[model samples]
Target: MFLPDAAATALLADALATTQPDLAVVHLHGDLGAGKSTLARAWLRALGVSGPVRSPTYTLVERYPLASGGEALHLDLYRIGDAGELEFLGLDDADARLWLVEWPERGLGALPVPDLEVHLGVEGDGRSCRLAFRGVAGESWLAALDERRRLRMLPEPSP
Candidate 1:
């Protein structure tokens, strides 16, 4: 999909709201200014987050309770120089209902394996996105997304 700017990215994020499974790990990949955080913020908002949704770049982790009654942990691993740093985030806990990770490569084996991966790249004045699924849950999410597209709940990505 080609997202022509932050707004288009938000549109994709909003579409993602319908496909939120009970628990899943999502790895968002992209370069700086590629709209990873924008999509994350939009997704959180779509989940009914009424408060601020700030990037976890400096803070490392941010927590949000979904309106549907679950907790989401948003993590930015950009500052993580080593996997050992991830231990401080208490990732071992199973309480997180959803995990949204940025720079998952930095955490590598230390982080939960992603159920879904959203890869974004700069394309012209916009971003190109590809969604990859790793497990049954991820596959289900993609299927749900496809259904949304078929039902016209999601706008087709620009060619």
Candidate 2:
């Protein structure tokens, strides 16, 4: 999908937040300034995170306690030199309900397999996002999102 601006990105994030399951792993693929952190922040906000949402570029991972009584882990592996470095992050001990990972390729072997992958690229002054599913969970979520989009596109009934 083509996200013309930050508002469009937030809309997509809202859809995902509302339709997401209790447990999910989402990989955000993009380059510098490609809006990966923007989307992730929007998603977190949509999921009821009211506090600051910072990028994990230097810290590696940022954990948020959601209002829904679950945790969301956002990881930025751009600076990771080796996949083995993930072991030191203690990701296996985390009990987060959602995982939003940027630069997932850098932690390929150590990271959990993504249920859904959002690929973003710069297009004009906006960003283009492509959603790809890796399993049944992701497929179901995408189907719900598609249905939501379809419903929104429908014309309103006349009074």
Candidate 3:
């Protein structure tokens, strides 16, 4: 479904804050400067992460300890040249962690399968996002975000 930039960002933050599930790994797929990192920053801010929050395009992973209560891991793989590098980062079996990864396709063949896929891309005024849940938990998580799955049929307000 499509959500305005603010709404989409809020939906993601709400999903993470409300559910409080064991693990949730979201992958943001899109081109460069397509709002992937923007989404990540919004999410981290919603989680009450203080101090400067920058893209992990260079160091790969940015770990944050939520001021209130939570933990988050954000990763950017756009600079990585090989999938094997993910293994070196020990992202192979991150079983119970909240991770937001960008440029996932670069490490698709190596990284762990995402629980949720938030597809973001350029649009007229704001980027469009498609949220897809992969595993059972993720499906349930999405259901909780959208109780009746009503957002799909609703027409977005024209900008």
**Candidates' lDDT values, in order?**
0.82, 0.88, 0.74
Tens-place lDDT digits, model 3, residues 1-159: 455566666665555545544677888898886788887887887777779998998999888876654568899999999878887776554443578899888887776678888888877667777778888878878777677443444347464
Number of clashes in every candidate structure?
A: 0, 0, 0
lDDT of 2 by residue, 27-98 (tens): 999989999999999999999898789999999999999878779999999998999999999888888999
After superposing candidate 3 on the true structure, give the runs of residues whose Cα lies further than 4 Å from its correct spot: 6-8, 67-70, 90-96, 148-155
Supply candidate 3's per-residue lDDT for 88: 79
Which numbered prediction scores highest in lDDT against the true structure? 2
Model 3 TM-score, all chains together: 0.81
Best by TM-score: 2
Model 1 misplacement above 4 A: 150-159
Model 1: worst 10 consecutive residues (lDDT sum): 150-159
Q: What TM-score against the true fold does each predicted structure earn? A: 0.90, 0.92, 0.81
Candidate 2 yields a Cα-based lDDT of 0.88
Off-target runs (Cα >4 Å) in candidate 2 are 150-159
Report the C-alpha lDDT of model 1 over 66-123, residue by residue, as the tens digit: 7777688899999989989999887686478788899899999888789989998988
Determine the C-alpha RMSD for candidate 2 after optimal superposition of all C-alphas.
4.3
The lDDT ranking, best first, is: 2, 1, 3
